[model samples]
Target: MDTIPDNIILHPIGVIRNTTKQPFLVASAAGLTMQGDLAPTMDRVRESEETISEVILKGEFTELLEGIDEYSHIKILYWAHGVPAEGRSLKKVHPMGRPDYPL
Candidate 1:
């Protein structure tokens, strides 16, 4: 009965709360490794083994998740923010200014 046809309301499942002010998190690496200004225009990111995020289900929605633990994997999707206007381009860029890394 709380559903509406014309609108969708998303209650936040969780947040990546952390002290990180710069780019943080990269797969295959441990600990924060932001080399100050390495990618400059782009951004440097690193991931630590520590998990600072949490997912909290609303009290009313908790019952809907009774049998989800059997699943081994899950996916979370979010909109990427903080993109600079100039960062959008159709041109290929040589990653790290190296000719071999054109992308």
Candidate 2:
């Protein structure tokens, strides 16, 4: 594997404040399956809806977001805490661990 460069830097601009206690999820068998079958009931519950979440900006950057609510959609990039920048690599993933779907 190639070595990581030292020039990169990342600083958190804001936080995703939500009611989610377990803020981490993956395609682990324990989390996505029951008796080797897809949990259809749970899957619908996990599907996103118009839930409330606040993107509280940092104190210094609060002024930078002056007219953000005018847009219909706002793209937010959340930094996964404790996950490294170079850790992402996925050729294919069975969406929700169902064999029929590979994303």
Candidate 3:
């Protein structure tokens, strides 16, 4: 059998600063209501980037969200940290998960 490396690596980039108080439970709630004051609230995912606010980026390696507002819309690619290790595994989607179907 091939020997595996004994070392592990870890790096954190930023914090998701939302109006989401109690993110753990609120995020986990099944079909949580976004009515009233919580009507699909909007907030920034704080990062340690030089262009962003300091109160948001409390850690190192957060220089990613800078100048993001210049665009009308921004696409984000990320993994859910709360998901289990097995859940993070890749899966083949139908049509390779393409947005448009073949004519």
Cα RMSD for candidates in order: 9.9, 5.5, 10.5
Q: Which tens-of-lDDT digit does each residue in 9-99 have in candidate 3? A: 6554444443443332122222222222322232222221223322344345355667867889554434457645543443432231222
Query: Who is ahead in lDDT, 1 or 3?
Result: 1
Q: What is the overall TM-score of model 1 with all chains considered together?
A: 0.39
Off by over 4 Å in 2: 1-8, 27-47, 82-89
Between prediction 1 and prediction 3, the one with superior TM-score is 1
lDDT per residue (tens digit) for residues 4-101 in model 2: 89675788888887665442334342333222334653554465354578889889999888897788988888766743333333445555545576
Who is ahead in TM-score, 1 or 2? 2
- Please count the clashing residue pairs in each candidate, in the order shown: 2, 0, 3
Predictions in order: lDDT: 0.46, 0.58, 0.38
lDDT of 2 at 64: 83
Which regions of candidate 3 deviate over 4 angstroms? 1-10, 17-66, 93-103
The 10-residue segment of model 3 with minimum total lDDT is 24-33
Worst 10 residues of 2 by lDDT: 27-36
Model 1 off-target regions past 4 Å?
Answer: 1-16, 24-46, 56-64, 85-100
TM-scores of all models?
A: 0.39, 0.59, 0.32
Give the TM-score (vs. native) of candidate 2. Answer: 0.59
